[model samples]
Target: MGSGLPRSIRFDERVSERLTSYVARHPGWSGSSAANRFVDEALRMEDHPGVIFRDGPADRRAVLVGGPDVREVIRSVKSARASEPDLDAGMVVSLVSTNAGVPARLIDTAIRYWAAYPDEIDVWIDEVESFEEQSLLAWERRQDLLAR
Candidate 1:
């Protein structure tokens, strides 16, 4: 991912130490790869004013600065959109903004993140849905045991 020649850029001593620590966090990532990813995330956050990337148990995700996870906001928007088919994409977001009680600006931040990385958000949505399904099944099994 370059214009050919490898380049060297200096950092503050403390910042260089921290970069090493950050590189250590990712098992298979080389220093260069991790640094590249970090720069990419910084640019993404800069591009989307109110969106930030966060680390989680599963992985890293884009989140609204003062709101819920971007995926959660997107899910709400999508569910609401399905019911209001006549509305265009923008209108459904407004409907979701009211229904979810999240400000439209925050929702827009998530929407922009979604537009940039829909595939990533969809993967997160699938993971949550799977977890919920497993929890429901576990609860039903416990209920059966209790009834007996």
Candidate 2:
């Protein structure tokens, strides 16, 4: 569509209805443009460890394949390594899956993404750690206030 080449395509009634609905829900999007965008985005996501991007609350985007958020899986792996420095990928998968209720395959998908995008995952991990530290400090302060 972006190549300035025009191509004609046909869709069934159900598919056409869905396209119309999607355009209606997404302001400033036309049916053809939405279809093209979704097709291109899906193709791009297919190459990246089976991960799919989805919109969540407050219009925030999340990377997900099947189970928990990719960040959540990475956080679990980091937490596990804190206790067992020799933990391997398979062990991390087992531990994260057991604790997070996500399947091993999805955990592997998250790990694959992490391998491909270590910098991005590291940023997420840092944010999580910072939040945890803040929460712990707040809890300690509350405890001190109650004991005073």
Top TM-score prediction, candidate number: 1
> Worst 10-residue stretch by lDDT in candidate 1?
1-10
Question: What local lDDT does model 1 show for residue 125?
Answer: 99
Q: Write the per-residue lDDT of candidate 1 for residues 1-148, one digit (tens) a residue.
A: 3543576978899988998998798688777877787888899989888988888987888888878889999999888878878998778878988888889989988988899889989999999999999999999999999995
Estimated TM-score for each candidate:
0.83, 0.61
Stretches of candidate 1 off by over 4 Å are 1-7, 24-29
Best by lDDT: 1
TM-score for candidate 2, please give it: 0.61
lDDT of 2: 0.77
Once model 1 is optimally superposed onto the true structure by TM-score, how far is the C-alpha of residue 104 displaced, in angstroms?
0.4
Query: Global CA lDDT of candidate 1, please?
Result: 0.86
Q: For candidate 1, what is the TM-score? A: 0.83
